[model samples]
Target: MDQTTSWGILAALAALIGGFLWEGGHWEGLIEKTALLIVFGGTFAAVAVSYPASRLRQIPESLKTVFRPAAPDVPARIDELVELATIARREGVLALENKIADHPDAFIRNGLQIVVDGTDPELSRQILEFEIDAVEQRMENQSKIFESAGGYAPTMGIIGTVMGLIHVLSNLADPGSLGPAIAVAFTATLYGVASANILYLPVASKIRIRAADSVQFMEMMLEGILAIQAGENPALVRKKLTAFMHTEEMSFARKKEESEDGTETEQTQTKRA
Candidate 1:
């Protein structure tokens, strides 16, 4: 489960409950099924009207992303790339032909296959970057789908609230019913605000984060592939690949120090020569 998504939902619920309690509220007489049905139904209807059928089907999966984010294994995969490159350099790229089919990651596997076929590094980079860009564009659209729903949610909520008020106001001749009717009318607004904040906005934000991470990781893969094709040493490749894992502050600092030391050593050797 995605910790952020789970924690976000839990926190939202906690805050709502705490706020209610702090306001001397009780659960009794607060059940507003009509309000819920109207707001939720209206919001979804509006969304359906706005988005295409394929995107409509994806709503559930998008929501699931909030709690079930796919783990980004790109950083760890860098080491595997280093190993594969070393093997290719030692035994020749042809030796990797059989293993290409066995690679679970289609991206790395395809790149290896292309390398074995003696594809130009420039061509390979272009193709791979194109594929990555396509994927990113698709993700962007999905994120926007949720964001679009968020834009509609609050307005739909208000629409529901208005509908409820219309019914309530028409029956104002009955003085005893005003309190219950007014409470029910307000529930739609509450539902709208809550769903927008807890669900739509957060999902969009998570998608954006996921998109950025994915793009960075793919760019790192591109670098590694090019380095492999250029016959760079595996250890040097590993050091370079560490740049993709800038999420680790310690790794960034270590890489910086190592780079500085490597330059110093090169300068010293040149002076001695």
Candidate 2:
């Protein structure tokens, strides 16, 4: 789970609510149900109108992805690929067919399968690149939904405030009630702006960040697949995969590989408020 992300969101809420309370504001003032309905319900209605059901269906999964992104085990992946390289060198490329079947990850499995089928390297790269692009485009679309919601929410809030103001004005004879009514009206604005900044836009950003990480991981897998197809040395394949890793990841992969054989093998493997 993304503790930092969860904690950041909590912090944002705590600070906002804490500051409000510090200023002597009561919880009742901020708990205007009508304002919430306008900001949240209207925002959802607008987003529903903007996107198709198929796309909207992705919201649950998108939120899941944002909060619990599947971080690739880079070092373990490098070790796996290097092990594949060793097998191919020892047993020939065709020997990988059975091993590839048991692999659950369709991305790398399909790419390696293509290579095993003797497809041209460039074509394999193109196909995998196209897959990456498709995945990226889908991710882009998903994030845009939240982004669009963020854009719409503030407007919905303003509209709610206007509606509330209109209601307040219609009761002009109740001079004593004007202040509280006006306060109630303005709560819509607060809900709108706050949800936009702290929820919608931030969720959209987290989704994009996680998507980029996933795409890069797939790219790394593609490189390893190609190296294996080319019959590169196991250590060299590990090295190529390691190119995608950070300094710390490089050390982890190296240590893990060495621990396996007592010999060094080189390989390497978001926030919302």
Candidate 3:
């Protein structure tokens, strides 16, 4: 699980509830189920109307993407690319046909297959680039689902509050119940605003961040695949892909290079010189 997101949500709720209790607010005052149904149900309905069910189905997977993000091993990817380049350069690109059929990443596997089939370099890059852009759009649209919910949540809350206030105003005979009724009505506003800020918007932001990282990782793969198709030197492939590495990836690359016995390829010779 993503500790940051989980802890962040917990801390926000703790501060809010703790502060409310500290201020002499009753715990029962915050548990307005009617208000919750209004905000959440209405917000969900609005979002369902806003996007087709086909897109809405992606919400569960998008949340999973945020919470259980795949940490791509950049250095490992570069190593694989370099190894593939070596084989393609030495044994000809077709030599990779029997190798990448079952490659882990669908992106890399499909890309290498295209190259093995002797697709033109320019056409290959276009095909891969198009795939990357399409993926980014799809991921971004998924985040927009939450963003739309966030946008609608507060309005739904307000509508609930208005409905509650309407009932409160109609039953003005009991002044004794006025205070509790008004407070209950306003819980809709609280639910709407709080859920938007603490949950929907935050989850949307997290999804976007994950999406960006996924696209960057795919771009790295794209570059590696293209370079391999071009018959670039394995050392050069490593050099090109290294620029895409984050700090932790750089550390991994250094460790892998250090463990080698100066005979893996020209990288050892390059390091020695």
User: What TM-score against the true fold does each predicted structure earn?
Assistant: 0.87, 0.93, 0.93
Residues 1-273 of candidate 2: C-alpha lDDT, one tens digit per residue = 889779988999999999999999999999999999989999999999999999999998898898887778888888888898898889888989988788988987898789789999999999999999999999999999999999999999999999999999998997999999999999999999999999999999998998888898889999998888888999788878988987899888777656854532223211221
> 1 or 2: which has the higher lDDT?
2
Candidate 3, residue 69: Cα displacement in angstroms equals 1.7
**Cα-based RMSD of the predictions, in order?**
4.5, 7.5, 2.8
Clashes of 1: 0
Badly placed stretches (over 4 Å) of model 2 are: 256-273
**Candidate 1 vs candidate 3: which has greater lDDT?**
3
29-61 in candidate 1: lDDT tens per residue?
355788778777877788788889987786677
In order, candidate lDDTs are: 0.79, 0.90, 0.90
Instruction: lDDT for model 2, please.
Output: 0.90
* Structure candidate 2, residue pairs in collision: 74-269, 198-273
- Looking at model 2, residue 148 earns an lDDT score of 98
Tens digit of per-residue lDDT, candidate 3, span 1-273: 889998999999999999999999989989999998999999999999999999999988998888877778777778889999999999999999987767888999999999999999999999999999998999899999999999999999999999999999999999999999999999999999999999999999998898788898999899999888888988778878887888877777767666663556567678888
